[model samples]
Target: MKMKISCKPIAAAAALLLGGCMVGPDYHRPQVNVPATYSELPGWTQAQPADADAPKGAWWTGFNDPLLNELEPQVAVSNQTVAQDYANYQEALAEVKVARSALFPTIGVTGSGTRQRASAGSTSSSFTRSVGSGAQIVNSGSLEGNVSWDLDLWGSVRRTIEENSATAQASEATLANATLSEQIALATAVIDLRTSDANIDLLQATVKAYEHFLEVVSNQDKYGTVAPSDVVTARTQLENARASLIALGIARAQNAHAIAVLVGKNPEELNIPHSAAMPTLPTVPVGVPSTILQRRPDIATAERQMAAENATIGIAVAAYYPTVSLSALDGFTQSPLGGLLHVANYVWSLGGSATETIFDGGERSGEVAAAKANYQAAVANYRGTVLTAFEDVENDLSGLRILAEQADALDTAVRDATHGTEIAFNEYQAGTVDYTTVATAQATQLADQQTALSVQQSRLLDAASLIGDLGGGWSDSQLHDPRNPDKPPAQPAAASAASAPAAQTSSATGQGAQPAVQ
Candidate 1:
């Protein structure tokens, strides 16, 4: 008796094979120690849950400088460093799509035609032998379509997609970080430029005062009331003040060039006018130290790196399982190139294959071990990044606090010095003190004023630094993940601005001349 094989059991087996089990552990975020409050300040509040999803503002706007407000926005558009990072981010998103494509079957179509001359002796069929001793011309053609699928039975492809997705998110964070840095740099350069202007103004006033003193001594010498040495001393002091005033121009020019470059312009293309105006030092609120995890882009980059490395462990673990491939071909072929698509000439096939490595000299085990080690290193790096972020905020806070006290003390000294300079000049005019005493008092007053100006500059610079260290309004929740479209979006609509569509279009093939800033 002939036995029949049931198609039902074979189909069921195929279905079970296609739906294979995953072998690796799922990912979970690693825990790290977080401080409840910032040590530098008191009454620190934790970041509210709602704040995580809140839209970030342009932090530079708080400085209240109209020129700065105008220049800061250009950094996102024209700065080459930020543009390069944005391009890298677009490339990362494309990688995620590449990894994702592996989850689906690859379908292709092919067509071919060939003409050949066959000798009679080479013929294996009677029909060809009947053609004669001469070579016979033969034509063949095929129209075929194929489907291939590397089944993700162990979820290796999915894990790879996960890794790429995390990496893409990390790239987004890196772009944000770069943008914030450039903005802060621009602000710093502006501060230095304004400080230079203030110094020039102070030196100009000192030169005028010195010139007046030289005139007074010269008049007294003509009247035979002051010694000739007094006139020489006054002239020397005036010349030195003029020399210092000329030197101040060098720093002012250099700072102006730096500001121009930060805004993505040539030095000659921009000319900031000297203004008595300066950026106001902004008051930044210090939240709990743990907020750094959600606030800082560098911290987010580290965290995402950890997640990517964790996904890599799953991919490496999957290497131990067998790889299964399913293939199908449907085609039409004819030897004479006639009626190729006819029912009689049509052909089809379905096949499945599985490959397993029984021995690899422990290569697979080594790969798995390496992947785990990388993940551990990433975890360590993440924790280290968190600690460094806290350190940065603390340092800024302490510097600002201490610098404020110093500024107040310098103000008092400046006031007292100005009064002493007037008294010394009055004593010199009354012939009670020598020109040396008046010169000494004037130098002290100038020094005190310059020191006070420097303190103000430091305070402004520290304020910008503190804002940048706090992520300049960026939050970890703003990461735009191309792989997880259904997840709640962390990127605000305003944050997307001009970058959203550009990023979307670049993912199709990852080719773009310039990537937009977020």
Candidate 2:
């Protein structure tokens, strides 16, 4: 004959798995008022089909600098700040695992031995229930395995996992943000260093020309064809040119130091070679403004934080409901040592328990309120970040637009000034123009060239900054979504790209990581 199985435990398990309802408001993406089109968008920046999608790694390659292509990858691997952020992301991932563990039962094994001489009339209720007091000396031993589980009848465990999973993803985004920032910073520093080299070359050329002019004036003085004071003025201009060349050393050194620290190297250990070639600025694709919500890592981080805090609301709400637990013990016990081995000595217990907080005056309510407030703060921060992203794009676009115009105008001015310098020098030799007038013209020519160099540097730096503000090629799906409590979300296309340097793809298709979600 077959024995009937108990239905009580089976029913309890089924109810725990099926009957619990999730409490609290499901997260909603805050209604941010994104602009239809960036008001400050410059006409020069049009959507290029080539840049329509941003690729993941090696954005610096767009500049086509072999050195930048080599150094940009180092930022992800060696930068100290990126290291810290990466460690934090690992910690957050561990926390997600910890929270997820709560959804399952815990099992423990226990063994105990006791030897005692009890008084004939002992009156301890707990000890009396488990042991007898008939004899003066007695020994007892037992071995047991216990299993306990808190039924998630109010979605508490699921909610905790939801919160922590999102937090882990937010931490991942933060790591990506750090990596992107330092890489771009290094790129800009490299640009500045190169520009300094070019300016130094320009100054050396100016000094040589000034020395020749001084020689011409000194010969005129010796021949008594010009005032002796003309020699003094010419000598002074040559000296000033040399001094300006020397002053540039300070800026070049500082920029070198910044690059060293950024790449996790000592200043003395790394020395960039001097070069006069200016880096070409790439046309970074300005996708539609709405893409800001999905492209940037910091924004993704902020948005994930909002979802994490939103899940806490339900966790706090779970506290208001009674907690249900199931516990079971299976063991062997006997009063005497030899009897403990007998099959009949086996004992077992199966039970359920419930706990409810009868009075805490408004603690649960206060906790719920605090969770809501924190979520609101995250929402505000997220919206603010979105607005700032738009501002960054607009600023970059305007920089490119206005700077393009300014550069064109400076080019014309430099050409005109060069012609003026030639004319002024010819007139000076002919005695038709004052030496001082020629000196002033030479100064204007040098100033215009230096200004043009600086403007080019500014444009390069601003172009990189605009790319950083555009989110350094990160996606929101890279982080876990809390709303899918029971489902496995598909991994993001570039999920592995963040941690794998070898996975770096060419910027051929905007970089190679993948186009971010629209």
Candidate 3:
């Protein structure tokens, strides 16, 4: 008998396996128009395609900053945003497991024993007759087990699993994106702090020059060689230069505080160097725009969301189909203690059921429509993200190019300003020019130096933006592979193992390009 029952379950499972088919429109990545080369920038060099399996991790190391390299990994493990997304990804994974569990049978066991007493005068004389002259006691015991399973006739459970799995993948991508963003912020803050220090140094030098001019003017006025008005102008210039130095300190302090936060330290704990240590901006390899589909985490996240929405449509459509279920109960029951273990007291039941919703007030149809609409919205968002990514990279490229040219021009200006100041000082000492002329030349020199520093900082920021927009050379293998969908996801250990060979290849070939920064 047990064999017969098992046969029915086996046959049902086989039928279900053969009949199941994933419904709804399958997900296919939307076609995007991509240019072979960026047209917005002239003389842009494209990176040659390397071996498909190459390690690009720790792209930040190209900057050669030991501190930054050490801090980068902490973002993935400890940053609040990344931690939150990791929790979300785990939750989605559990949901997928929950949905998949519905495909199997559920078994439950129950046992009970009871005793009851009846009063003699509780009923009519017939009830008394049934109980007999003396008090009668009745006792019963039973143990039972039930098995139930829902036959997924329309693939609803499968679709649910699919949707949840895709959502989990999206959450994983979110974690990666958060890490990328934090690293970029850390690098930018560091560069800004250094720029501030450089500017302050320039301002300090200017203030000293102004003080010297004020002393010279005072001497000339005492000797009646210069008017009182000229002395007043010299004093005012010195005061203004001092004020400028104070203002520069404000920004430098704020930038230092920002860096402290990024490194997971308190502002008071941070001790950045007072002098400038200019960061190097690495030369980024601009790959093809088509590669953007796989490289950018936000873009990958959008694509995964689309997959989830597509699966939801299938789930909604399945609501129109009937549901089938099988149930069975087996047990033994006896009224007497001696008969409790007898086979004659055994009881069993088995059944199957089918349910079909005849009317739903158009709710099911509305659900299907909503799912379709959501899928369309996801597709639009994905395209927009891709376009935005392209624009960001191109914009940074243009910025770096123009800033490079500006820095060159500023270099020449600083040299010319220094020469003018020297000549002006010589003439002032010879009594051919007023003290005011020397002060003006000194101010010009300071402004030129500060401007040059500002341009360098801008160049560094643009470099950071370019690296970020290009996804920091992140590999597609971290997310999904379009070429081999059946391959299991690369675990951390597996990823590390795979990356080793690529690292070796990169080292051997010397194909690794450093960041372009001075």
Write model 2 residue lDDT over 1-518, tens digit each, in one string: 11122447655675677456888878888888887666554222233334424344567866777778877888888899999999998888788778866766776778788877766554333333343546355567777777778888888888887788889888888998999899888988989988988899999999999999999999999899988888899999999989989999998999999999998999999878887777877656555677678879989889889999999999999999999998877778766444665678777788899999999999999999999999999999999988888888778767766676578799999999999999999999999988889998999999999999988888888878877887666656655544344666565544333321111112343433321110
Q: Which sections of candidate 1 miss by over 4 Å? A: 1-20, 43-56, 119-134, 485-488, 491-518
lDDT of each: 0.79, 0.77, 0.73
Q: Tell me, what's the RMSD of every candidate?
A: 10.2, 7.4, 6.1
Candidates 1 and 3, the one with greater TM-score: 1
Q: Choose the strongest candidate by lDDT.
A: 1
Residues 91-193 of candidate 3: C-alpha lDDT, one tens digit per residue: 8777777877787788777788766555554433321234566554456678777788887877888788778888878877887887788889988876787
Collision count for each candidate, in order: 0, 4, 6
- Cα deviation of 392, candidate 2, in Å: 1.0
lDDT of 1 by residue, 1-518 (tens): 11123347545754674466666777788888987666655422222222333224676766778878899999999999999999999999999989988877777788898877787555443233244657776677888888777888898988898899999999999999999999999999988998998899899999999999999899999999998999999999999999999999999999999988888899999988997876776545454566667778999899899999989988999999998898877878877676677888878788999999999999989999999999999999998998888888878777776676687699999999999999999999999999899989988999999999998999888878877887877778778777776687665444322211110112223433211111
Model with the higher lDDT, candidate 2 or 3: 2
Query: lDDT (0-100) at residue 449 of candidate 1?
Result: 97
Which stretches of candidate 3 lie above 4 Å from their native place? 1-19, 46-55, 118-133, 219-222, 336-339, 480-518
